[model samples]
Target: PLGMESGAIPDDSITASSYWAIDHESYRGRLNGVGGVGAWAARTNNFDQWLQVFLGMVNHVTGTIIQGRHHHNDQWVTSYKLQYSIDGISWKTYTGNNGSEKVFPGNNDRSTPVTNLLVNHIDARYVRFLPQSWHNWMSMRVEILGCTMNSKFLLKA
Candidate 1:
């Protein structure tokens, strides 16, 4: 849950792109514990166009769920790379054994969401959904599933 009222969405993206079919706030549905009607949209059909959601603190992210626009499939992401960063500017792609950034494929059915479970735990503050390829434009509703930094490790230090 990264985009809910408890979290923050970068304002630079809110009004920066014309491709938004709905407001960016809608991407936080899973954060609110309820699904929302709106989805975040991008202005271009380009690679690497993305949105970032801040959890307000560091977390041990375990997995992620991405739902395409519920009403239709026109602008759904067809493939993407999930990236996380402890500091907003420094990002590391969640990788596979091949050492390349793992590309998670999306569903053609708009209503069915896609998921990515990280190969290893990621201690991060920001997460980004970077589109590799899309049907037309990039749009999604997201849920970042994880928990707060484990205190047991801190105590050990």
Candidate 2:
């Protein structure tokens, strides 16, 4: 786990285009937090909204786990696309084997976790989630899957 669910990832590393309120702030977007309502909720439901995470260093991102607001059952992402960056300036969208931008399916209801394994793992320091379709409003709690590079590997790179 990348540590959002466990609070290992700091609040500074989590951000979003906009949040509904303080309680639904980006930093609250941790799986199982606040009885599951601690998800990041956009101020408005739109295609431009995004949730982002900075890993502090590059990591091999293999997959993602997402969930919606637990108690509400009304707000949740149904689908989304991923973009990753090494320097936070230039970004590349994750693509399918066909070389098209890949859209990952999100949760159907609140609380239940949905996991999606990447067909091509990404090595990145920053990752953003762009919601495509939603149940009512765009909201989500997420955790990234990957392993950190060992000292030897880091030195070689």
Candidate 3:
């Protein structure tokens, strides 16, 4: 997650609303979810400021994915993404940045696994992620490794 706005932040209490402490060593491995889910964070100062979220309804029998370690640029990672949504407000095929992950300098991206996520019938509530921009403020750590599924089991990738 990344943030800066409050008038584009000069330290006006850090804008965009200002909330901190979410870089819990960044999310690395093991994830699962279900319907009506949503994620799109905003935190950090700059070097740690990165964001481009789009998360919602990760359903597919209680959606959960994190197969075999994904995310790089090491150093506790500073960029990350994983997007999906059916009607959370127009969004599809995007695991990270512009869709089709493998980001750098914090551009995050993901998607395209037969529409990345949001099962077949399209009812995805909302799910988003594009955190850690990494500028300097220091605060981003995105990583993943495991997840199975849950939330009504609509298995049909």
Clashes of each: 0, 0, 46
| Order of quality (lDDT) | 2, 1, 3
RMSD of each: 4.3, 3.0, 15.5
**Better structure of 1 and 3 per lDDT:** 1
Ranking by TM-score: 2, 1, 3
The sequence of per-residue lDDT tens digits that candidate 3 reaches over residues 75-153 is 2224444444656457553333344553323322221011122222222333333443432232232222112234345
Assess the local accuracy of residue 19 in candidate 3 as a C-alpha lDDT between 0 and 100: 29
TM for every model, in the order presented, reads 0.74, 0.92, 0.22
lDDT of 2 by residue, 47-114 (tens): 99999999988888999999998665478999999999999999999999999999999998888999
Q: Write the per-residue lDDT of candidate 1 for residues 20-126, one digit (tens) a residue.
A: 44444434333322334346667666774775666667988888877666553455778888878887888888898788888988757555777778778788887
Looking at model 1, the pairs that clash are none
- Give candidate 2's whole-model lDDT: 0.88
RMSD of 3: 15.5
Question: Largest TM-score belongs to which candidate?
Answer: 2
lDDT of each: 0.64, 0.88, 0.28
Among all candidates shown, the one with the greatest lDDT: 2
